[model samples]
Target: MTRPQPRPGIDEIKPYVPGSAVTGFDGPVYKLASNESALGPSPKAMEAYEAAAGKLHIYPDGSARVLREALAARYGLAPELIVCGAGSDEILQLLCKAYLGPGDNIVMSRHGFSVYHILAQGCGASTKFAEEKNLTADVDALLAQVDENTRILFIANPNNPTGTAISGEELARLREGLREDVLLVVDAAYAEYMDWVDYDEGTSLVRAAIGTGAENTVMTRTFSKIYGLGGLRLGWAYCPPSIAEVLNKVRGPFNVSLSAIEAGVAAVSDDEFVDDNRDHNRRERARVTQRLRGLGFEVGDSHGNFVLAKGRGDAPVEDVTALIEFLKTRGVTVRQMGGYFLPDYVRISIGSTEANDVCLNAISEFASQ
Candidate 1:
């Protein structure tokens, strides 16, 4: 029999694991695994989706023009600068494919979003894991790792698993120090949850680069988080017009679905819904983080919809495992951070007040035990 052949990198790649979606467990399970909005989709977006369902037979606009226009208008950017994708994940992959190849390298934080490493490896590109300080991207450390061969740098604002953010000044410094040829891809997937005065989604950075005729910065955004459109799988990237053109060439023409396009357009226009969700997440994230820290866990300062708490520092791993199990029995599903290389930490998403109460109670009980 003939053996199936594959690329060496493909063989080494591990598939991403989504949060469990099992229903009808012994107790009611409040899933906080995936960093999704608990508020659900906006009424406007749902209406648009329902209206578009009848037109499923027709192919989606290849350029996603409607959604692009909506996003551009909202962001004060040119429509030509945007490239929509299935999700920000796809946009990240596109950047990797367009810019990275064998012999090229990308710089990323040690515990940044997994997609950066996955996409880099998928393209047969090497990665330099910049040492993070306090679970946040250390811009200076990342700058030190850059070389001529480093084609891309990915920074996840409000980084996953740890939910820590780098300040705007630090980001600007990193950009100033970066090699002219290196492209910075800022992933602002959780930008809406931030209430910091100096926090930026990297839009200004991208705009500054464009003004300077520098084509080395791109920023990605998603409809999945604050918009509650994870199921729609809609995301976009803002880049130099030249880079956007290259990505468009490599991207599948019909990468986005009809329903997704309609939902994305409506979602972007629903400012009230987005604002309300952001406000709720900001308030609850503080509440959750404070409560977790009060329980003697070292919780990081989070600017995202999730808060990460490090269990007892000197405690055994089994002790943490036991706490997780106890919480699972209480129907609160938080993300275990072993995969993200933080074994003593668990990430809990900011949910509705009631859901958060249940999770806090579970944690309290586990601590008492």
Candidate 2:
């Protein structure tokens, strides 16, 4: 008898390559590969997680109502417009499932998150990548790529790996230029940490779309970054009421875990912890960018909690491949950006002072070689 075969596009999909978490020489390893909070979760969130341990047998609330209300209150959004998922990643996958299919396509920047491609194609859809300029998402270029088959356009605000972002005006222009039917999915996973004046996480656009009855835009955010809830895997999307209703229909009855809902509610309420983490990331990002540039490396203009550093000097240091091998030997693990199509750059997450210093010291030594 013949076995069941997988779908057509599934075979073409390349699995996402996550950042390195360990080095072979593991003496006091400093893991800075994934862009996560070094400051850790808030005390209140920790307490909430612990509180959830006693209720392990009870099923989680299928609607995730409490967490939805908390996110609405924190962001000044309507609870009815929010949808919670395992992570912003799940939210993206849900969108692909809802909107895309065979012969359909999603357009995005060439350097946008790899998961977008994975999510779209896994659902039997294709991806269209527009070019970028000056390491930033070019709005006109993206708009130019949108044709009749384009069902969704995904963009990572303060895009990962490169950590560069486009402004609100450019985003608005792109939205207005698109046909009313296409969905605009903005992945603002790094929104909380950005102190930029013009970045609004696409909330305003989503609201405006609702007001005009277009309801063509939405923004996805995560608890993994500033909230330090990576392990819990909680995230939400602020969408028009219609979109939220559609997502609720297809998602699992208890899509989010009890612990995640409890921890997320506590995490959003702790404004102080969030502020402190943002401040630390802001300061360290500046310091690290400056230090990397001073050491003769080309660092991207990053607005997220990490920076993209490329070797630009002579000899082995100029080759990022060698630089990564060198850092690995020193018990340091930073992400190689080749998967994101950035072969010459290494993306380093901003860590606590000691972690950052150790990572920098290792790089400094490599620069001297």
Candidate 3:
């Protein structure tokens, strides 16, 4: 008897490995693995989430209307140009589904988010990785890799794992160089955490795509970061009318949950909460980076809520496993970077003051030993 088979590229796709949440030590664990907000969700959002429990029996608004309008008002974008999804990850998946095929390919930075690779492969498409300079996306190198077959170009500003970012000028240059037909998707998942002068969230680029005949750019964002709604899985994209229509057509009828919608509406409306969260992250992130540098680790100037740090001295790669184990013994969970091909580095999320102190003390102890 013959067995059924999945799609061609499905088997070949490497499954994504999330940061480890487990530890051997029977003590308090500080989960600084994933880049979750240390401040937690807005109290108003929590109230909305609880209130939405009564509406679980009813189907969510397929359009996610109120949430879209809230995002629009907050960001100063047209509501019709927005497309909400379960998370920004789903928005990427929808884009891949609509645009990618066996012969097509997507281009992205070598050290960028790994989910882009998985999504492209799921659509039976290949991914081209451009080399980065100083752990940041190089506009010239990325453009060089985009050939005739490239359908999409993905950029995660203040990129994950590495936590480096390119300037707004570089982003615009990349867009100008791309073919009019190739879709440019800027994944600004960590945008809210970036308080840098040169940082651009790619919203202007998305708006620029409107009047231009070639409406080929998109900017995707998340509620998981500054909004602290990672558990609810709400995200959205700023798109041109054409792309928004395409996504709306292909997406699940009620992709976002009722709870997610209500919480998102409340979260976005609470500007004071977001401001406080950003301020806390800015302070903590700077402290963490400075302390890690003082510990002799090679740390980039990260704009995101996490820092990517490599071990001390000449043979850093050899120190990775031992250091991670040492931190585990101290009940701190930092992500290993073997999956991102940076075996020497570890990514640690910025946590509360107490949590940060615990993690730092663990590393300091490891260094002494």
Scored by TM-score, the top model is: 3
lDDT of predicted model 2: 0.89
Which ranges in model 3 have alpha carbons more than 4 Å from their true place?
none
Q: For candidate 3, lDDT tens digit of each residue in 1-369?
A: 889998899999889987787546798899899998888888889999999988999999999999999999988999999999999999999999999999899999999899999999999999999999988899999999999999999999989988888889899999989999999999999998877798779988887777677899999999999989998999999999999999999999999999999999999888889898888888988899998889888898888899999877788877877888888888888888877778899999998888999999999888887
- Candidate 1 regions off by >4 Å? 21-24
lDDT of candidate 2 over 227-337, digit per residue (tens): 999989999999998899899988889999999999999999999998899999989999999999999888978988999988675642347888788888887788878
Q: What are the TM-scores, per candidate, against the unseen true structure?
A: 0.96, 0.97, 0.98
Greater TM-score among 1 and 3 belongs to: 3
Write candidate 1's Cα lDDT for 271-369 as tens digits.
899889988988888899899889888888888889888878577366567777777778877777776777777888888898899999989988886
Worst 10 residues of 3 by lDDT: 17-26
User: Where does candidate 2 stray beyond 4 Å?
Assistant: 313-318
**Candidate no. 3 TM-score:** 0.98
